[model samples]
Target: MRQYWVAPVGPFHTADGTAYATSITLTDVSPAPQITLPANMLEIGSEIELEASGFFSNTATPTLLLGFYLGGVAGVALAASTAVTTTTAAVAWPFQLRYRGVVRSIGAAGSIVGQGRLYLPTSLVASTTRFIPETAALRTVAIDTTVAKTVTVGAQWGTSSASNTLTCQDLSVRLVT
Candidate 1:
């Protein structure tokens, strides 16, 4: 039998008028939301899913980076998307990012393999959304499942400008066993 668990982290939404121009560990509400994976919480075939939505505006086209971390924004990287260059400037574009990973092993040598994708709007006037696929080859990450782990997501902008801002509107994490 399979069981599912929703991490008590978020549906975190950023407050209006709050945006970040530099790389940041995203937090809109008080205290950034994080998923706590307890020791031995994962077994072989266990899976995790992370989803987020946000808006971005740029003065000039800049490369955007999104990543998943084990502890916090500065922690060990589990997976990251390749830098994606924006196509438009001075326009508020909405984006959705999602990642799914499955545990391949457990114990001290526990590992998971995952991939992520980003959905970005090419134009506000047009009904087209650009699909930015994660370019990194899927690989196993060594995570010690015998100890508790914290997970977080972060965003970075290649160029810093007042007009170049990003805000995470929502984020959620889930686990399946």
Candidate 2:
């Protein structure tokens, strides 16, 4: 190959005076966290958040929420009594979500509900960003295990946190990790 033209995105020659075209172009190369929250389990006053490549990225507080639901009844949960915490840039945050004043499951086969935001973290992206969503659909935003370890989402939204609408896209929420 003499050279490669990745459209207007790329075009270059190899050190050997020859080059090849890129097989593909990848974006949003951020880490994605694998959650391991169990369902129908009573609040144990313990919480955790984890992060890895291709999991959880650019998550926002008050945007990403975790809850355990049973049938139509859902109980608001905190990462250890914490409701909201700040998410930095490509980094992470650790905090506890409180569930003291939340309801417990009154049904079977409960599921953990979560939310994803499209906002940028103030700590990392402090340049005052527009916070616009690339897609009008759901965003892949959530808390990272690094900065926010524990937190409560129920109380943060208010007393009727259960009534809050839990929406997200490209999200895999389940009882098992």
Q: Could you say which candidate leads in TM-score? A: 1
Report the lDDT tens digits of candidate 2 across residue range 19-138.
Answer: 111111111111122223334332322222211111122323333323321111122222211233434232432212111112222123222222222232345334222221223231
| After superposition, candidate 2 runs with Cα above 4 Å error | 1-62, 70-90, 101-177
Clash count per candidate: 0, 39
Most lDDT-accurate candidate: 1
Alpha-carbon local distance difference test for all models: 0.66, 0.23
Encode model 1's per-residue lDDT on 1-177: one tens digit a residue: 855665544434334324677543342211244456788888888888877676778866777776666666655557666566876574767777777788999998778888766676666644233332344443467788898877765777777667778776666677876
How many angstroms is residue 92 displaced in model 1 relative to the true structure, after the best TM-score fit?
3.0
Cα distance off (Å), candidate 2, residue 43 = 16
> Using Cα atoms with residue i matched to residue i, what is each candidate's TM-score against the true structure?
0.77, 0.19
In candidate 2, clashing pairs total: 39
Write down the RMSD of candidate 2 (Cα, Å). 19.8
Candidate 2 positional error at 111, Å: 18
